[model samples]
Target chain A: MEASTSRLERDYRRVLRLLPAGYRRQWGDDMVGALLDAEQSAAAASAADEGPERQAEERDIALLQRPPLREVAGVAALAVRLHLASPSTAGATAAARLRGDAVRRVALVGLLAAAGPALLSAVTGLYWPVPPELEALGHTRVDALASALLALVAVAAFALFVTGRHRTASVLAVFAVVPDLRHPLETLASAWRVSPGTLLGAACWLLVLLAPLVALLAWRSDAPRPSRRWLLALPVVAALGWVPWLLWRATGALVAPDAAGSLALGAAACAVVALRRSDASWMRTAAVLAAVGGLGSLGQLSLLGYPPGLERDLGWTALGTVLLAAAVGVVAGVTGRRWSAQAAPTAVTAPDRSASDASA
Target chain B: MALTEPAVLVLTALVGETRHGYALIAGVEELSEGRTRLSVGTLYGLLDRLSSEGLIALDREERHQGRTRRYYRLTDDGAAALEAEAQRLAHLARAASARLRTARAV
Candidate 1:
């Protein structure tokens, strides 16, 4: 009985080891005691009800030197709960006031950058000689309406982003990505006979859709709102994004699908600015998001046999974003102390105390 | 703050008197009619959060048979909060009963 009890104790400790060191130090022995107490009571009840043979079998199973999967899962859930719980440290406090900061400037810039594709698509989709089947939805009219909606959503996102409503802008941006996301996916999936060009186009479109979403996530609710003077850049964005790009792209045989990459570039640039600021922990998160996005897009691109033009187009612009993301990611990783140690939430210089330090 | 079911159960477990971790777990199981069983890690995490939020306080500690035992009880604030939650549940129950009575009459 003593040997079985010791073996069970070892197994319980092994399971309890899943908790953070600080937490274990505070309540480890007490917790073990509680567990043993419960187990002993359960054993007593089972012994009373069941036969001796069942009790011996149960003791053998319990002493088998293994913690149950339920116990392991419970510990994992506890870890998650511990991670999500707010720390007592002041450094980890939420920054809700960044709502009215320079994040708006970046979001506005991204909106303007994104506006180009819609304008280009709307205009060029008009003059381009699409096949009879391509014109099924009244050709240019339906195309124009879709572009207008995309541009509208982008503008609305910019407005909300600048006005200190990051979450609302994020939601709007998510809606905006739907059309972009659907277009390429549908184009690629429309037929059993898929072409290399269509695959590249789909990848490109997917990248475009993901850029704004990643940007909005990076900027999030923590970014400061933009300055009013920065609002003057709207006219430039309008002219460059909508007017000229549309005219230029529409006039060509090939449509320049550049807006999503441009938006991602803008997003990465914003992340850089966020990282340089004094209150930049959230900015660090933004940088990491951009890095993950860049890597993910690259992974998607790697899976496809991209055409030569697309290979060149994606390699430079998309890869440029990745490089920028890497730069920020490396800096954030190297310099950030709180990000790593926050999992085991305790002061770095805190003196170790025994569990006997508890107050009644 | 709106208490989760587990938080409510923990509060209920401590209502009678200060209880150590094992006793509290047993009390919660008994009170909840054996429907709820909190693991040690989960219970401690909840207790930490509750203590941090000032809903519960450490009452006493004792060493029994080479094992350390820490006891906890609800604070005044916790008692008041629990009372408020009980009233809210009662109100909801009364409303449900009224609806059932109306249905039966129809």
Candidate 2:
């Protein structure tokens, strides 16, 4: 009986660890003690009617059946109750919430809406030839110049739309990605021998239809006051993802390059965005490493087939390398800054408690 | 068969009379011959679930032995459930005993 009581006490004590750190610090031991005392009293009363030896064996069996410490359901229920019971820790930022909701809704709708028309135009075989005046000037050069200009415009529109509530800019950004999205559908249709133009058109129509809904959500939302630096990181990350894709389009035929670098850069940029939004250091670090490795490999490969005696290719390679390195440094610095901001105060609070204890 | 040990004991404890939290805990402990003892939190959590399911109803609130307590009484559904479970267990025990006797004779 005594042995079983001791085992039950140990089990209960272990379970008490699931309580919040603050709650455990205050009342864990007391709760465990109360549970043990109750168990002991119950055992004593039960022992009165049973044979002494049988009672001891029964107690042993009962102790063996003690529940495990990690009760997932219990902890989940407690966590939900705690969260609902507590007031919003982010404080009175209803305006910020509204703004954030608006931006998120706009981005979601724009992305969903653009998916269709882009695919349709691609499928319908709408070949966008270089303008006649530009064609007379030089077909390849004019095409490249047109593409570069469109890329710049798209990037600018995306930046403006993300940074401020400019409805026109947002709409333009949505249209800008339309051409790019259509390119994939066109290729798919040509290969599969099926018409995907209607599907693409429908998708674009849906996006256009949903524009008002996105705008309304954005307008109605209380603008969330996330750190401006963190907010700025979003566009930077998006631009980083865009650069490799643009580069691929420009140099894909000439370079016949592996897509490994672009994938690495995109993943790294996503990690930076995620790190800024959440407290995940490992993912941020992984993103940085993947970006660096991918860019370094691509830069190395780009230099391999350079024309003899023309160091110009080397210069471009060096420039690309430098840009990639700069991106890694920027993302790491942001991640470090965010981590330190959250970590420093928690470190300082520990020593003050010991000093107070000594004084008491 | 689905009734948890705690739920069954709780229902058995309230078989004849309504009981509050502290009394229910005590009664369950006594009825189980102290084989199963539930903490106050566990008891309350189970009671809340049972009440929500309509198997048990809050009967009354009164001061008992200096502590305010809310008494719970099993519904007809709960009693019927307990009876069904008891019969199932009894049937299983009888079958097992018969099997053991047959094995010993063989």
Candidate 3:
């Protein structure tokens, strides 16, 4: 029994590692004490519910030596919530930690926002053929390198974020965006001379360019580090983000063919998957990134105008952009709130629930 | 404000006296008739929220048998919240009873 108890305790400690360092520092002991108390209570209750001779023999076995999977999943979800919600510092200096947390949060979000469109642009060279003035900047090696870096850094940053490298992801995201900031700013400065549509598009681009900096300042500390299993489906998701654009380019480049219905369908599919997941953080993030990326492309479309005579293509693209973005928002919000509600009481009765609802 | 089931149980546990994490776990089980069992992770999340909302406060900390036990108590805001919830539930119970009585008469 002593050996078994110690093993259980060790398992709990490993599970605790999913949480941020600062959170662990502050509440780790209390958390351990509560878990042990719960284990003890559960063991006693199970023993009382069983026959005496059987109880004496089975008490040790009843309390699992391994941490239950659902419990661990719930705790993982809590870790994400705490990471997003808690502002505990974990850097060498107070200011640095705050700054680091702030920058990382923004850069992460900015990274997500930029990633999909950036990938699509890189894959298809789907640059908006701007006015003759803008076209003068032509495709140069420097431009290609910047695009490559942007795409690589965004994916790497997202991969890092999903894999629990908080600061490194942030640094990568900031590094990716800083070089491109000047162009958006310069574009925005000429707002007075540009068309209204172009001005709106530039403003949106400026926001996209500036988001990471804002995110950097906005986050306090204790950014989220959810489970790495969240990234297991990254390739599929990355494909989903770009494949539609690819299909459009290949099949109907002149028309910018309708991906809106497909985008909505994809969002609905993501929502279905997310609904099945108790945490669904990964799904939510993926949906948000997809939506933001679509918006980015829409902004580019505005800058590109009607693309010769493809008025319908621009209209369809714009519609898909709005609907997909809205679909992600609606689905993410509903799923997030529902999961949050499920996280509470369900965590307590998890063992029984897991046996009944294996999908949970 | 409407509190979640765990938040309500936590407030009920801390309504009269201070209790530490282990004790609160026991208190909540008792309060909820054993239908709800809060995991440690859930408890702390609730505590974090309740504390930030000024509904609960840390009373003190103590070392017992090599374990640190930090005691928490319900604040005035917590007591008020609990009372309101109690009234709401009581009102619900009363209405159900009255409807049942009318149905019996019918």
Candidate 4:
């Protein structure tokens, strides 16, 4: 019985190692004790309802049993909460607030970037004169109307998100991603007939569509809502993001327009942070944008096989810009977070003497 | 803050008593009418959070059968919070019953 019990203890201790060293140091023994007691009680209860032979067999089985999967999952959940400095974690107010701010900014800026081109597309489709030749190719009034509505959903997602109607905005944002998925799905469906470059394009397209949704995890109940003043930036973003890219495309096909626009957006965000009081929040936002842009640039690789022309040139140009942005963004973000950690005042509470004595 | 179901059960179990980890788990299971079985990790996570929030505290500790056991108790704040939540639940139950009676009558 003693040997079996010791072996079980060793197994549990191994599992407990998944917890942080600090956490283990504080509560490891107590946890072990609790786990052992619970197991023993459960085993005893089961034995009570069994014959002597069955009871002996069950005891052997119980002695060899490991901690349950649910218990392991619960520990993992605690680890995530501790690592993220989630709001419920105690005495990590500064760290939690900083993390919350950074995540919130990423979501807001991502939606803003998405909203810009969408709004422009909707407006131009509604107001711009369709050339006779283009109309002859099969463009119809219904097609234009559908396009406009799609864009408007994206724009509404951004507007409602900034104004704090997050659940509705989330639904709208999900709907907005549907149109972007068409080309990607088409590419992926043709995988048997297409090059690996096309596959990369499909993956990148999916990533771009999903980035804002994934970043939406920032919207905890305690997350601060973006101020309404953010709405004023919409027009500016539309003008800056689309005008230069459109003009450049019109003159001569440059880099992938979306890639260049995303790189420029990331730069603009970084510049805003640089010009103001620098903080971890903006740096993290830049990091997220640059990471997304860098990954998105992979889509351009699909064009490299094109007969050496504008498409090929675009592939190379976009790839370089994104790579550079990602490298710089990562470095700056890590450094800024470290500096912020050093500067923030950490609160320290004395350990409970009674609890310590109990453990001893 | 609104308590999660498991948290509410734990708090209710701790009311008017100091209980060790296993005892608290049993107490919570009884309180929830066997509907909730809190694993060791989950119970500890709740205990850690509740302790930090000042709603619960380490009341004492003891050694049982060569293993150390720590006991937790509800603070005044915890009792007050639990009371408020219970009243809110009561109000909701009452309102629901009243509406059900009206609908049945119709």
| Clash count per candidate | 8, 18, 3, 0
Candidates ranked, most accurate by TM-score first: 4, 1, 3, 2
Model 4 docking tier (incorrect/acceptable/medium/high): acceptable
| Tens-digit per-residue lDDT, A1-360, candidate 1 | 134356666777777676556566667778777776666566655676687777766655545445556556766656443332222311121221122122333345556565544444444555656658867856665665665656667666656666677678778877876765777778678746777755765765676566445445335322345555544555555555453346547753222325544544454655566556533544544553454445544533442355656455545555555565566566655545444344333342112222212232
How many steric overlaps does candidate 3 have? 3
* lDDT (10s digit) by residue, model 3, range A216-264: 4333324556446645544554566656567767886443422233333
| Two-way DockQ contest, 1 vs 3, winner | 1
Error of 3 at A292 (Å): 9.7
Q: Whose DockQ is greatest here? A: 4
TM-score of chain A of each: 0.47, 0.29, 0.47, 0.71
Best first by DockQ, ranked: 4, 1, 3, 2
Error of 3 at A51 (Å): 10
Model 2, span A53-139: residue lDDT tens: 866665555454454343334433432232222112111122223223423433432332232222322322234645568567776
Instruction: Please write out the lDDT profile of model 4 over residues A1-360, one tens digit for every residue.
Output: 134355556777787777656666667778877777677667766888777777666655665787778767766655544434444454234555466566667677778878887888889878876657868998887778778888989899999998889889988988888777898889888899988877987888777667767777667544557799889988887776566577667866565457334643654576367437566656766666677777777777666677878788777766675666666576666667676776684643223423322222
Task: Report the Cα lDDT for candidate 4.
Answer: 0.72
* Residue A61 in candidate 2, Cα distance off native in Å: 29
Which candidate number would show the highest lDDT if scored against the true structure? 4
Per-residue lDDT of model 1, residues B1-106, tens digit only: 5787888999998896988988888888888999988877667767766775567787777987576798988887778889999998899999999999999999
Stronger candidate by lDDT (2 vs 3): 3
**What's the distance in Å from true for residue A156, model 2?**
47
Candidate 1 structure lDDT: 0.59
Q: Point out the worst 10-residue segment of candidate 4 chain A by lDDT.
A: A349-358
Task: Name the TM-score of candidate 2.
Answer: 0.31
RMSD of each: 8.6, 19.8, 20.4, 5.1
* Pairs of residues clashing in candidate 3: A102-A216, A103-A216, A106-A215
